[model samples]
Structures are given as C-alpha cells and as structure tokens.
Target: MLMTTNEPQSILDRSGMTNAEAGALYRLLTWLSPSFPVGAFAYSSGIEWAVEAGDISDAVSLRGWLAALLADGSGFCDGVFLAQAHRAAETGDDGVLREIAELAAAYVPSRERQLETTTQGRAFIEIARAAWSYDGLDLLIASCGGTIVYPVAVGIVSAAHGIPLAPTLHAFLHALASNWISAGSRLVPLGQTDSQRVLASLEPVVAATAGRALLATLDDLGSATFRADLSSLRHETQYTRLFRS
Candidate 1:
C-alpha cells in the first residue's frame, strides 16, 4: 500500500487566525519594510566618515564602532525617547508627546544626524498615516507642527500596532546595527560572510542595550561626544563619499 504525501502547512495556516493577530503581523511587516518611507536607506549616520578616516577600514573596526554606537550613543538615546513617547501616546497626553519630540530633536549632535532623524521621521509619519489608519497615530501626526523625530514615530506606530515598547525598541536598534553593517560591508569591502558575523556579534549587545533602555530615563540620553559628533560634522565637508552622511 502506497502512502499519500501530506505536506506540512505553514505556521500561519496551522495556528487559527484572529483579526488582532493579523493586524499585528501587518503592522510589524509594514514598520520593518524597506519601502516604509522612513528614508533609512539614504543616511549612513557618519559611518561614512569612519570609513574615509581609515578608522573603520575593516570588519573588525566597523563592528567596534557599531557596538559603541548602539550601546552608548544614538541607539540608547532613541530607545529612551521611544519609551517616553509610548507612554505619552498611551495616556493621550499631547503635551508630553510634544516635549518628547522636542527633546529627541535636540538630542542629535551633528547637522547630518539631526536632519537624518527628523527628515526620516516626518516622512515616516506621512507614510504611516497613509498606509495604516490608526486614530491615535492620526492625532499624533496632526499635532506635529513641523518635523517629527524617528523615535517619536517608532513609539506611536508601535503603540498603534499593539507591540510592546521593549521589543519594538530592540528591533529598532537591531535594524540600525544591521544597516550599518551592510554599509560597512560595501564601504570597507568586507565579505558577506564577515558581514553576517558582524551582525551576529551584535545579538548580545542588542539584548543588553534593550535591557538598559528599559531602565533609562530622559536624563540618560548622553553620547560619546568626540568621535560621534566630529565624524558627523566632518562628513558634511568630505570631498568624496559613497553615503549621504
């Protein structure tokens, strides 16, 4: 007797679906999508300068820079703002949200990094409102008088999507690290396998950073001043470059 083949079903198909689950999945995919209009592809966040300066000319150096960045600087700052924004949105407190937005805007040290956060933020808000119709998100967008910062947008969208703040913050940092690794792989001529290794090396850092972010307050948004700020400013006048910043 010949047995008939029974192909396994996808997890999505196997687990019975709910509207909430579908909505959450949709929001996660949309937020993480490269085409989400966050403009993440355009900015290199000063890694370009590190490459040009011979400081990050190899995978090892690039990984070190990225690790310091995520653990100590913009990554940590953004996570704090994201958590604050989430709380403000949850409470329907526009005043708190506005304050958080202003703080995030002022947190960046260089012109390029400043433009990077706010420009992509404003763009993300527009795309988010267009793509996902959430009432709270609409309210938040309408409240923004000018450019919104990236962390603000992340918080609002994460709340709208029903994702917890900690995991959302973790994913944001992970994506940032990965983006830098990809840029480094090209700029430094690192092999794809080496790039993967660099990213894998960041898993523990990401977890520790997220844990730290959870306990972080608004007052804890300090960064490593010299390298981070100087690199970003120097990138502005770099005679030749592959990245915008």
Candidate 2:
C-alpha cells in the first residue's frame, strides 16, 4: 500500500536502484514504447475528432486538451484501472482482476473507443507473451474473458514481471499522454518541436495522475471530460477521419 503524506519515508529508499529494478524499468520502457507493435499508432483515442471539431488546433490548445484528459478524463480512469489491476495481480486475486477488466472494457463511451482499447489490449498481450512470456500473464487474460483493456493488460503484465507499481504506473500514463500528443501532432499539423514541447509541459499532470492512481480504488474511477467523450462518441459518424478512434 502507498504511504500517507504524514508518514516518514521508508528506510528502504536507496541512493541507487538494484539490478532487478533496473531490469524492470527497462522492460517498462520497451513495453510502452511507441514501436511496441501494439498498433497504438492506428488509433488517436478521439484526438482526431477533437482536431476536426477545432477543440485542438495548435500546441497551446493541444496541451490544454491533453492536460484535461490526463487529469480528469480517460487518462486518470485508466490509471486507476491499471493500479487496481496491478494490486490484484500482485495479490493473486483473479476475482478483483475479473471485475476490473470487465469494468474497463465496458467503460468506454463509444464503439470506436471500445474498439481502440480492446484491440490494442489483445495485441499487447499476444506480443508480450511471444517475446517476454511469463507464467502469470494468463491470470488476467482468463479473468477478462479475452476482452482485456489496454491499461489493465499492461498492469497485469507489469506486476507479474516484478515491476514495482509506482514507476510502472508513471510509465503507463506517460506513454498514454505521449500517444495522444503524437496523434495531435499529425492532426493539428504541429511541428515536431512543438509536439515535444507540449509533452514536456504535461510531465506534472502525468506525475500527479499516476500518484493519485497509486492510492485510488475502483470507487474513484470516473471521467468528467464530457467533450472528450463526446468527441469519441461522435467520431463514429464523422464525415472524414484518419484514425480508428
């Protein structure tokens, strides 16, 4: 469990991470990387529609949009699922894992959103098992009934691989924000430099999101970014589009 702010730091805090932690960190980087073959590039998670609707047209607006997503929208909700899945996996509680996986799958606001998350989730699991096979990976797979959502897929694998929750949660949210920024760069036609700038500006939002998720339970899972969800819902019938969601 996470410690409260009033408590002192654990003596286990070290000046340098151990070899095992170093390895786990490397795995997280690889798994969440844009080139991970999860086909994450094929979906924009509704950023395509937002750009078309002028909700995001420049670096400034894109930054603000992503900040909200990472804080009060699907980003935070996914982080909560990820953290919960991680805990369930760590404790070998398939019952809670099943509930989380199903809830995450059903939580999408649109068909495309559901398609975006579950398709990538399925691919994520298949690839991870192929390259980094672990015995415990199937625990959540069985629980989700083959319809795993992306963040929960990642959380389960991360825990089974011995990755600690804090860094894994941080990396997951960072990758999420990064992917949305990538979609915005293409849709808004922003310069690569500006895209990097927008991502850099979101570091704090990502950090705070992961921190809250680390302490959150299922009761805290919800989204308030109505526009973002509406964009996703309306994208289904959009006249023109370049993304799958």
Candidate 3:
C-alpha cells in the first residue's frame, strides 16, 4: 500500500517534510507508546483464558502461543486490514476505506474479539483527535459511518500523517506482541527477567510476521489459531477473569 522500496531513502527529504526525521520518529513513539491512552492494558486477547486453561503456563508455552498468534492468527488478519486501510486513506478512496472498515469490524470470530477491537478503536480515535488533529484524519473519520476496528483506525491515522507503511506495520505488530507478552507475564506469574527473555526470543518471529504481513492481501486474511479462537470464545463465560477479552 505505501510506496516503498528496500533501498533506504531519506523520508524527510523525499517527502518534502520540513521537520527533521526525528520529528517523525517522535510521532511514532508517542502514538504507539505504552502511555498512549488506548486502554490496551485492559484487554488480554484471551491470554488470560489460555493461562487459566494451562495452555500458557510458562515462558516457553507463552512464546509459542504468541508466535502462532503473530504468524497466522488475528495478528495476520489485522495486518492485512491495516495495510488495506492505509492504502485507501493514502489514495483518498473513501469508499474503499469504508468497505474495509465494515469488513474488519465483521471479521472477528467472537463477540469479545469484536468488543476488543471496537472499544480500543473508539478510544484511539477520540484520543488522537484531541491530541493530534489532522485534515486527512478528520475526513477518514467522517467517512467511517459505522463502528471502526483498531487496526483500521490506526492505519488510516498513520497514513494520513504520512508515516511509512512497513515500519508502521512492524511497530504495530511488535506492540501487539509486547502487550500479549505482558499479559502472559502477569497471568503466568513469570518474573520480569523471564518476561524479558520471552520478548527477546520473539524478535525473529515478529520480524518474519511483519515481512509476511507487508506483502499479504485481504484475501490472505485468515486465522489458524484454533485454540486461540476457542480460548477467546471460552473467555466470554470464564469465571474469575482478569482481562476484558
């Protein structure tokens, strides 16, 4: 979606950006920073359920679960949606963007998964509007007639702000993986050292998944994390749960 090449080009100079590249980097940091008010801490994406079910009881199990998730599950599906939405926003194709938004909202396999995306998406939009307003962003918002998903909302905003696609997608996937790792840390009762180790081990997988997502299309969107999907559905009625999803 974003016109990109393996060759390294100075985005600051190539895009005619008046500010230094540091400004763009800072924007990405702030937007994706853990302190950002998307309420990501409230949802576990079914990791809590997985923990309770003993599917993720240790660092090794957690890492494997997250790897599968990043490689072929919601992570892959969301990446395709984000890339498509970003392309639509970049091209000023409101119709395509709207269609993508609706499709993304409907793509989730369970009710909690739906809430997980839509709630965070609504929060992300509202906070971004108040903190970093832009003409292109406002246009995208006006065109989204129904509920928006988190990845689609983020894609539209990132594109509107002139952020490059590959790094944006990579950062997004990394952030999600980190969040899941954090959830696993708490749910698994792993120490900080073990948590960091798990995160470190997942770097290669994260890179591989990001590279795959960059070249993936909407037709490639599908989930093979059968247990993960079942876990999310099971979490709906889970007793004594620690996460919202």
Candidate 4:
C-alpha cells in the first residue's frame, strides 16, 4: 500500500508530525545557545569559590569537580527534577509541575545556590516567553506563581515543545558542563585546548547521568558533593568575585 507523505503508517505516529519537522535539535540548540540571553555566563555555580579554595586549579581537577556534579551532586538532583517536570508537563499535570518547582526551589543547600538557579530560571522564562512563546510553557510559568527553578523551567519548556526527554536532559547537562568549563578556563587559566580536552573526557559522565535521570524519580535525587555546596555558600561572602555565584 502506498502511503501519502502526510499519512501515518503505524499507530506510533503522533499528531501526524514527521520526525524531520520535530525541531528537537534546532530547539535544543537555540535554547541552549550561549547567546540565548539567559545570563548563563554570568554565574559560576560556585566554581569561583572552588578555584579560590584550590579545589579546581587545573583542567584535571575541574573535570573531577564537574564529574561529581554530573554523577551525584547538583547535576543529579537537577536532572531528576528536569525529568520529573518533563513528565509532569507531558502528562498535563499542573499539580505535579508545581510540586516539582516548589521542591526544587527549596532543595538548594545555600543562599547563593538558590540565587543562581532562581535568578537564571526567571531570566530563562522571560526570554522563552518573549521569543519562543508556547501555551504549555505559558501555563507552566503562570502556575508556578513566580518561583520556578532552572531545571524545572528547562524541563517544562522542552516537554511542552515536544523535545524528547532524554535529549533535553542531555542538552541541559552539556550546557551546564560547558558553562562551568568556561568559568574554569578563566579561573584555572587553562588554554582552550585543555578545556576542550576536559569536556571530552567527561562525555561519558554526562551521558550516564542523562541516562539515569531519564529513569530517576524524586527518590533518586541527592547530592554528595558537600564541599561544593559549601563553596556556593562561601562564595556569597567571597570578597572578590567575577561571577554572581
């Protein structure tokens, strides 16, 4: 049987949309782009403190710090939140979405960390609303009542726009790693080549975290990077600072 170009051949077809026009790759790239104006470059996520404390003084140390984050720290927690929020959005569960947002906001271990996520989250929502406005995301933001966490915002928006969950989480983690690497580069004074090498070595960690996050729930969320959390708190009082947190 000959099928028309727009006709579905199987029940797996969703909304008669073709994979070629799904726009997942383009949306992910644009939303995560450095120039997206979410102010991602202005925050260090405590890398500033880590550098000052000599915890991340070289490319090797930087990789280790980020690996912990990806494997079992803020990255792990955020990835879980992102996945749950994505599921909530996918299921049209405003209650679950709100719960996730509230929990994520309250889970931060320090004031600076809170500021980092909330501030960036607000900025991300603003840009997304202004540029990539969508009803699902609009409702999610409206439902949050002005307190959305960064990962939640990213998750809701991605799910609302039909970006698959795993890739969205992967892109989120990669964007995070890239931002931290940029900060480490300036702080550790690593050359461009070394920075690239560090990111390359951590690819497996990022992939593994994303995979785990896809199947993880709130129960799976936890951070073992106590010192890293402390660095964020300490960064709040660090006399000199190049980044916000």
Candidate 1 Cα outliers beyond 4 Å, as residue runs: 1-18
Worst 10-residue lDDT window, candidate 4? 6-15
Query: What is the lDDT of every predicted structure here?
Result: 0.80, 0.88, 0.87, 0.87
Write model 4 residue lDDT over 1-245, tens digit each, in one string. 97566444342266454664455677789888777888888888899999999999898899999999889899888999999989998888888888888999999988878888998888877887788778667777776656898999899888888888888899999998999899999888899999999999999999999999988879878889988988999999999999999
Q: Which prediction has the highest lDDT against the true structure?
A: 2
Give the CA lDDT, 0 to 100, for residue 146 in model 4. 61
lDDT of 3 by residue, 215-234 (tens): 88877888899999999999
Tell me how far the alpha carbon of residue 239 in candidate 4 is from the true structure, in angstroms, after superposition.
1.5
Cα lDDT tens digits for candidate 2, 1-245:
97565222232234365557667877899999998999889899889989998989899999999999999999999999999988988898888888888898898899998999989888988998899988867765787665899999998999889998898889899999999989999999999899999999999999999899888889988889999999999889999988999
Q: Rank the candidates by TM-score, best first.
A: 2, 3, 4, 1
Candidate 2 accuracy as TM-score: 0.91
lDDT of 4 at 161: 84
Estimate the TM-score for candidate 1: 0.89
Error of 1 at 208 (Å): 0.9
Give, for candidate 1, the lowest lDDT window spanning 10 residues: 4-13
Model 3: how far residue 46 lies from native, Å: 0.7
